[model samples]
Target: MTMKRYPIAIALAVAGSFAGCWTGGVIQLFSCDDPCYGLDPYECDDPCATCEGECLPPPLLGYDDPILLWTGEAAEEAAVPECPPEAPGLVFDGYGGFEADHVCPECRCTEPSCELPGGLTGSASAACDGTTPTSFDAPAGWSGACTAPAAVGSGELGSLLIQAPTVSGCAPANDAGAAPPELPAPWTVRARGCSGEAGVHTCREPGKMCVAAPVPRPTGFAMCVRYLRPGAPECPAEYPELREIYREFDDTRSCTPCGCGPLEGSACTALVSAYEDEGCSALLGAETVTLAGPKCVAGPELRIESMEARWIKDEPGTCAATGGVAVGEATPKGATFFCCQSDEVIAVP
Candidate 1:
């Protein structure tokens, strides 16, 4: 399924430099510390991807041919300091410089990206570590044999997983000569809203899955898992009918790995010969945010969550005038973009 993200962390006033920015950063590995991400030349297509998870990137920033970086650290790829929906982000002035906020609160990441009738766990992020899932869904049919050789020393570390299908409604036909029905089978990523039907799976990541609790649904809203009969197609035609086109399902694509290259040791392997600007006044220490922002910022009826900006003066207000903001002061207020609380995150001057 094609998913477009709306980076909620992007403020559009400053550039960001950090790990979560999709432009170029770390890769989300499994839930293991000291993860050694393997990059093979021709392993699987793409694995360990987090399309809709904690590292949801803000709309203000994005990735360009992003390569996943690996570390054997048991880090929280899905955890942000304070935001509810912990996602990677960028602080960009849109003039060639940036900062990594690690939180995208403004962008819309809904699958098919049409604002589903739920929370923001369904958003997207560009800065997902290997531990943080980049993309996952039920394999088309588990029809392929993946007994390929381990790519160790071969230059690429790939990822592959196998799970039993979760069927509900119909009892899989095991009769002597029973014919399997031609319907879609049950399968999906471990996301929350995904397992609405017997044949579907769901995500559990904080800001990337179902809300803390399921809300009351209107009349025809669907929510039970359907057990697909054996011998069914992957996805049937005339499905979703525009609302949630089956293609938009969280686990639409299988968790396959894409060969990148041999893994990097620690810190940085290759080094630069000389320095251009000994000191360019670049930022080093990163700013911290709340862990509950994502939870408070999602849903059709959101809130007036935050406000911060840089390079602006009065009328715009800074931390000095606002409170403990910690960003954007020595400029004109009109020269900045601020994030305001509303039904959904709204951008203000």
Candidate 2:
């Protein structure tokens, strides 16, 4: 009974257990055998782990993009750039910038400066205050009268005051024996009778005259002409043809017909050309005439001479034989006719 024996495998397990207990319960069979002791002790099995000193305390956080570590200790901050102070007489353009001078009313911004619009300039009577001047020069070609001196100041910076000029005085006269200065277009000269010993000439109002007459005197002559105005007839007796046309066409007293002048001093040839241009096919029988007359005319022997003439095809039939005294033949009841010749229309014999 004392000769009992264990298996060889059981005997080896008992010996291994004793060795494990001696090494703090670590089994030597699969235990890590690191030559670098205590260096990353937990990383003993990691292939990339090295025994190079202590693990460097994990790179101290944010090593790539370093920032100031605000510890309990105090330190000075980094310096920053300063901006320039604002200047006087300048206003911000609302976008991180400033503009020179104050903006003016109705002002337009031009490069390097601002501009005011052009307008009528004249002097007006106004009392001058302390800041405003009593008098100033009016704009060119303009005149005005002010009881007191007045100044118009600009809204912009360093703007100057403007003064008005007087416009009521008589214009100066020209030199003796010299031709008078020509008036502006549509403004002719007229004689305002005689002023004392000297003859006086003045410009007539624009659009007032229908005909321009020659200057009567050499020095003090002003242009005076007839204008096409209604009421009292100013038709010159020299142009009897125009008067006759006016009588026939101007029943309503409208001045329109008078404009078709045997215009003073114009030739008959020019008048005929003017009438043709005005869509008149014939000149009728007048030295000077207008298109404002009856359209149709009946005659014993009618001849259509104008290139604008066409046969009256009432019902689409050939015109009657070219020449002869035909009664009621070529006459179209409500149609207009014009005398074909350049001369005046003569009464049938």
lDDT, candidate 2, at 107? 14
Off by over 4 Å in 2: 1-27, 31-54, 58-349
Shift of residue 296 alpha carbon in model 2, Å: 69
Query: lDDT (CA) for every model shown?
Result: 0.19, 0.19
In model 1, what is the error at residue 48, expressed in angstroms? 7.0
Q: Give me candidate 1's TM-score against the actual structure.
A: 0.12
Worst 10 residues of 1 by lDDT: 111-120
Those runs of model 1 whose alpha carbons end farther than 4 Å from true positions after fitting are 1-44, 47-81, 88-330, 333-349
Candidate with top TM-score is 1
lDDT of 1 by residue, 203-297 (tens): 32322222111122222222211213333223212121111112121212111111122212211111101111223122211121121121111
Q: Assess every candidate by TM-score.
A: 0.12, 0.11
Clash tally, candidates in order: 101, 20
Please report how far candidate 2 places residue 88 from its true position, in Å.
54
